[model samples]
Structure formats: C-alpha cells, structure tokens
Target: MTSFSYGEFAYVYDELMKDVPYDRWVEYAARKLQENGLSAPSILDIGCGTGEVSVRLAKAGYDVTGVDLSDDMLTVAQDKAQGEGVQLSLFQQDMSQLELPSSFDCAVIFCDSLNYLETEDQVKGTFKSVYDHLEPGGLLLFDVHSLYKVNHVFGENTFTYNEEELSYIWSCFQGEHPNSVEHDLTFFVYDERKDAYDRFDELHKQRTYSVDTYKQWLTEAGFSKVETTADFTSDSPTDKAERILFCVQK
Candidate 1:
C-alpha cells in the first residue's frame, strides 16, 4: 500500500493546516452549485480528512456524507463532527472502489487529494466509482497539483517549518513517471507529559496528469460538461499555477 494512509499524521493534521482556507473551498463549491441551479443538495465529500470541510458544509445546511481510506483520519473526523454539533455520515473506503448505498447530488475531492492516485487507471477508476455513486446530472469537483508544480517546483525541493511544539523537514524527489514526485517527511513533536520531542517519519507519493488528460478521463468515466480552473480562481491555469481544479457533471 502507498504511504498515503494518514496513520500518525492524522493527529497533527489540523494543527499544521490551521491556516488553510477551507472557507474558500466551501465557497467555491457553493458557487458551483448555485451556478448549476442545484438546490438543497446532498453532498459526498471524498477524502474528507479530519472532517473540516465536511463539517463546514454540513453547517452550511447541506446533507453531507464523508469517506476516507484512513481509519485514523475518519476517527478524527467523526469526533470533529460531534464537536461541531453537526450530523455527518462517514465511512472508511477506498475512493477507487467506492460502494455507497445512496446517491448524492454533488461530490468533491478537494485539497488536491486526487493527486495521491499514483496511476492513470486508478484516477479513472475513482472517477467511475464516483459516477456510479452520483445521481444523473450530479456534479463532481476536484483539484490536482499542476504538472508545472510537480515537475519544476516540487522536484528536488526541501522545506522546513519550525514551531514551538511541532516541526518538520520535508524533502521532495523526482519520480519515475512524468509529473510525479515522492515526499519524504520527518516530524518532531513535543510530548507534553514526557517533556521530550518524539520523531515520526512518513513517505508519500503524488502524481498528476495534464489538464487535457484529466478531462478525457472524466469524459470516459461518463461525465459531461467537464470544466477546469486554476488555484481556486475562475480562470484557466497558467504556466505558473500550482493547482488545477476540475468540475464535472454526470
């Protein structure tokens, strides 16, 4: 299995992502729903890590269901829903082989989680599975790291972040395939009771295809009206854009 499993990372995810603009992601989804004339939508949140966006959407009055491959992540997400006083239907399942009893009006794979699929077939399979779980005319929204970022930006890069209680050294290496990268991350976290720092290491791989390739796969998976944007904007992606967003309708 790929190291994409959250594992120990789940406990510290929100702490590291405290500055993430989850509200903007929710706003983007809401905009798409209104533009498509969808009302009172039921949402399916694929790869809903830690239930942050899931709970946010539920609070926004959408009936929300979340799914993730990591049991640890789902456990945190379930607790988060309870803490927020919102109801969420959550499950543990692989997105590529998703099986759900009910269909949804809209589905989302946000935060560039789709890039975690290492192969073209896996990406297409996930799209197909999502299509099967959606109603006709349903929408699917997702994002991926742009090819430029994968090939030029992340390739052979090193980043470090330091805080009082948590720190990490992140290194990236070029992958065997085009527009792919492997991440090597080591985290040092303060143990309050023991008053010492504990170290944890995690390796993750991510790959992304061209925008045209993504559109083609979505079409092959029975989606129509597939459109794309860049980095949360309504404009097309440019050479420097780091993220690409896709909106597809089934």
Candidate 2:
C-alpha cells in the first residue's frame, strides 16, 4: 500500500475539520506555559497540519513555528497564516529528524498527530529530537490515540461523510503490527466547472502504544517530569479513554 501524503487532501482539510477545538488546544498550551512560569514563550508546533493551531497560538501572542512532512500541507498553512494576518515560520520537515537553528520554550504535537508514526524507533527518535530542541525547563505537550481507540474504534470499521462539494468513504483494517490500523479512504470532490466529480484514494496507517511505553521513552530521552491526562481533561486516563495526552518537561 502507498503511504498517505496530504497532496490534494490538503485543500479540503480545513473544511472537513471545522468542528475541531483548535482554540482549546492553544488555551491548554498557554495555560500550561503560564503555570510553569513561562510568559509569552516560543512554541514549536510539530505536525502542524494547515496551520490551524499555529495561527491561533500566534494570535494568542506566542512565538509560533510550524513543521510538517507534506509540502502541500505547508503551502496551505502558509496561505492560511497570511489570510489570518498572523506571522508563522513554517518548514517541511519530518518530526523524527527535526532540525532548527533556535530552541523553543514549548513544543506541541496535537490532533493525535503522534499516532501517525508507525514504528517504535520513530517515536523514540521524535522524543529525542524534541528534547534536543527545547530550552532548559522547556515543555513538550502532545496527544495520541489510546490503545482502546486503535483496537476497538478504528479496527475493521467503515465510515462515511457526505457533503455538497465533497464526500468520502473511509474503511479501516487491521495493520500488520499490534494495536495498529490502516485507513483506506476514497474521496469524491465536485468539480463545479466540469459538472462532475473527481475521485482519489489515500491510505494512512496509525498505531498506538500504552502509556507506560510512552513514559519510558520520555525517560530514556532525558525528560525530567512526565504527566498524563485523558480526553483534554486533567484526570488520569482510564482504560476506555479514547485519547491520551502527555505533558513532559526538559
């Protein structure tokens, strides 16, 4: 199967994601920074698809830099930042091999972006890279799909979305690895000029490990403190939690 790249998918991403709570993510980052005695900290937004969260952080008066693996997505992000009248430094880079000239006070990987990494080594490499780029007392915040979600919610499931301009049929199958899912999506977008629909297909793979595994990786990467929360709240995750959030300090 071909790997997923946000090529044409970048154009419809924002429209499909209108209900995402981007403001809440920014607020969480800001509040965490303030609680840690960091005011107006510089932020590194890893896997910042379409710049939604990055632009919001900039508007919230934080220095924001965005990184993504897809050039098409970064192009959309650049346009969005300009339209929103926000300044953002954006780059196309793999999260596991991150490299930048300056360090940041906080690094965030939101929207379950960390789940896209398909291997244990990639995830560990990403933690090490983020740790290298953080300043002393810096914070690293990220979220991922819980193991239960990967196994029960996405495994061998089918979903569909219908709209006037766009529609998609999404099917999920078990991946080769444990606790992993491979999503096969077929999209049909209306072509108003041609009075027809154009179709495309994409394949995406996502995997999740347990909280203990992630914490061990953070410790191996030299993080000083680590905390976990569930579904955007400050409570510890239960077995049924769909999302798991991690807050680590360097």
Best-fitting candidate, scored by lDDT: 2
Q: Model 1 over residues 1-250: C-alpha lDDT tens digits? A: 1232367799999988898989988999999999998989999999999999999999999999999998999999999999999999999998999989999999999998898988888899999999999999999998889999999999799999899999989999998788899999888888899998888888889999888899888889999899889989989999889989888999
Give me the candidate number with maximum TM-score.
2
For each predicted model, how many residue pairs clash, with residues at least 3 apart or on different chains? Answer: 0, 0
Q: Estimate candidate 2's alpha-carbon lDDT, on a 0 to 1 scale.
A: 0.92
> All models: lDDT?
0.91, 0.92
Clashing pairs in 1: none
In candidate 1, how many Å is residue 96 off? 0.4
Runs in model 1 with CA error above 4 Å? Answer: 1-5
Find the 10 residues in a row with the least total lDDT in model 2. Answer: 1-10
